[model samples]
Target: MDALYVPQGRSRRFVEQATNLHHFRLGIFLEVIDLHLQELDNRFNERNMELLTFMACLSPKGNFSSFDKENILKLASFYPEEFSSVDVMTLELQLDVFMDNMLSDERFCGLQDLNSLSMMLVKTKRHENFPLVYFLIKLMLILLVATTSVERVFSAMTCVKIKLRNSMGDQFMNDCLVTFIEKEVFLQVPDEKIIDHFQNMKTHRMNL
Candidate 1:
């Protein structure tokens, strides 16, 4: 019997190519629009009345279709208190709406501009709102948060499974997992007598 062969569909390949080209065109359009909006934001920054008016309309519940949702989220993360000073609940609901309706195009357009806005919010509010400022002060906090907290939790879970008894009873495994999970909490415990016992054990082991 001769070996059988099949070719991929040419029409499917053509459709994929067309879709990619359309996406590229949209990406270019969003970039050009972003350049113009940036220039507008810069021009309006010093014009306080226009800036505040623009800010207000972009408020969480402002009745405008053109308000940028990404800008509101960026502002909220950076200046939660100030951003909350105005109709906070409305803004929060608006945030929910924007988050739900947010598109890839808006994300691509607003990311850099939002970064700059975040920095400005941090510097401007640092004096009075130190704790909130600390939250927004770092640009890499998003990465930091994901890597340290989330990754570490998963890592600890894996470590517990690997280092402990694989065939142990489930309840015993649960207890071990909890012990590993709250390692930091144990470190913060101020039991001096327990500390002395550990120190003595270490000293005995070293002597051996």
Candidate 2:
């Protein structure tokens, strides 16, 4: 335990001298934690963290233990197009009724998540009764799915546009990206149809 810690692939003179415990605590562990914190900060900035907190209020886990009437109302305010000033006023009342109904309802006792809560509400025909709340839930779910889809597109772009293809034009890159990202849909398109469509675009020396 008293032995000095030597980092691999480097000279001891160029590196800081320290014991294994000190090196692991101050160097490796702290550096890894800082990197993780930086990544989290980048991914969840102020706006995103606010949205996440609001969305968590809508979760039905633990019998809606996380539900917050005020936060949900604030979440509705974020989508002014969906909830007008008048609608927000109505939503406040609706939230109260919705909470009461959900608490008293036996069917809503064990909902695991927002998705299950949404499904249960629709299945039990309670969505009609709590339309505003349901709308908020749907909006949260859509935002979650949209964020994932956008990340997927960015990830696909890295794969589709490699170092060799970096010079591709924006329009061509977008077309290729769309095809690559939605390969399942593109795969359903027959090759003959694609060839005929290209052939009909202009006169060709040979029939493609």
Candidate 3:
């Protein structure tokens, strides 16, 4: 279809006039797909996706079907503070034993996820026996949960520091943010206790 593409609610002078196929292929389809790709790139960039893939290798679902010894070892390398060179070398052997222990043990069979696996290891005291594997599982769980929490804090910051409060000092803003984000804990405290605490900070002639 070579007919001139005139978009609705727009004048030809304001919009570029092109063939129908060319306009749809380049302007509409390509632009929409490019935007979606950009959004995906922003959300799950190369590093994040790679880390997620490594994390998935530790999943216990389907009886630890996703487990990969090499990838798990690579994942350990990411946390050198926790896994030293010696620990990493020993972890390879531990992973094999851990896999055998998990596969042979009926208790570990049919486990749902990393959380359940961690709980089961703690409950059965196997975490002590397989400390390295247990540590990796905990790290994976923490990584996932901490990412969500950090994002949530950023979201909360936007709510706490809106345009009207943009000029708030950093220390005051931080205090306000802590109270706002942890409102549940703050709500439990009595107003009188808060007032008394502030009043007692320094000697005062009068108490309100």
Question: Can you tell me which runs of candidate 1 are displaced by over 4 Å?
Answer: 1-67, 70-116, 126-148, 167-208
Clashing pairs in 1: 60-91
**Who is ahead in lDDT, 1 or 2?**
2
Instruction: Report clash pairs, candidate 2.
Output: none
- The better candidate by lDDT, 1 or 3, is 3
Compared with the true structure, what per-residue lDDT tens digits does model 1 show for residues 43-67? 4465434434444433323223445
In candidate 2, which residue ranges exceed 4 Å CA deviation? 185-208
Candidate 3 TM-score, C-alpha based: 0.81
1 against 2, candidate with superior TM-score: 2
How many backbone clashes does every candidate have?
A: 1, 0, 0
Candidate 3's C-alpha runs over 4 A off are: 1-10, 18-33, 190-208
Give all candidate RMSDs, comma-separated.
16.7, 2.5, 3.3
Least accurate 10 contiguous residues by lDDT in model 2 = 1-10
Cα lDDT tens digits for candidate 3, 17-115: 789999999988999999999989997998889899988888878988999989989989989999999999999999889989899999988888889
Question: What's model 2's lDDT at 48?
Answer: 92
Ranking by TM-score: 2, 3, 1
